[model samples]
Target: MDSQTGTHDDNMKPATKKSLRGFAAMDPQRQREIASLGGRAAHQSGHAHEFTSEEARAAGKKRHARAQATGESPRA
Candidate 1:
């Protein structure tokens, strides 16, 4: 379960395995509001730290190596 939003556990399920039927059931305005609220919340929580392009590339390489060793992609 998503502790942050009380939504279904998307992390536990593969993206391709999930259906968008429920997502389409929601109001577009409501969805936009929810996404905007989440973005603001994340910004307020100091979660959007800055990372230079070089740093990001280095991190990606390290993450790829780790994923290869563990047989799983690294989480965002």
Candidate 2:
């Protein structure tokens, strides 16, 4: 039973066991190494974009304006 929600434990569905496949199966260190390799490859191939401070500020301002107009929260 959930003390806060006042729900009976038996009414809840039992948790199922799931096998972690592909990237999800990897350990954190292995994942970081794989991601690092991809990032390095992208930069070496000139496919990666590094934003300037001014550009980042402009993008943030634009995002804020769009969010304000749409009555949605701005992303951090």
Candidate 3:
């Protein structure tokens, strides 16, 4: 019997994939509203990992605060 054709088990466990359970469980209309409000799109689309509107605003606020403390304009 060829080694390649042998029935030996490889014994490797299948990898667990990441899931978007919370977001995906929302109603379709709610999902669409979130999307329209700049929430991340579902799945691993290029835009999926991006910040939502509230997150972006919070980040901007933090950046502005940091810039002010360093005596620099936030625009820069």
Q: Tens-digit lDDT track for model 2 on 1-76?
A: 6999977788688779999999999999999999999999999999999999999999999999999999999974
Model 3 Cα lDDT, one tens digit per residue, 7-61: 6556756579877688798889998898876644444456656579999999999
Winner by lDDT between candidate 3 and candidate 2: 2
TM-score (C-alpha) between model 3 and the true structure: 0.37
**lDDT of candidates 1 onward, in order:** 0.84, 0.94, 0.79
**Can you list the residue pairs that collide in candidate 1?**
none
TM-score of each: 0.40, 0.75, 0.37
What is the number of backbone collisions in each predicted candidate, taken in the order shown?
A: 0, 0, 0
The most accurate candidate by lDDT is 2
Clashes of 1: 0
Pairs in steric clash, model 2: none
Write down the lDDT that model 2 would get.
0.94
Candidate 3, poorest ten consecutive residues by summed lDDT:
39-48
Tens digits of lDDT, candidate 1, 2-75: 88987887559645765567657689998898889988898899997678999999999999999999889687
Q: By TM-score, is 2 or 3 better?
A: 2
If the candidates were sorted by their lDDT against the true structure, best first, what order would they fall in? Answer: 2, 1, 3
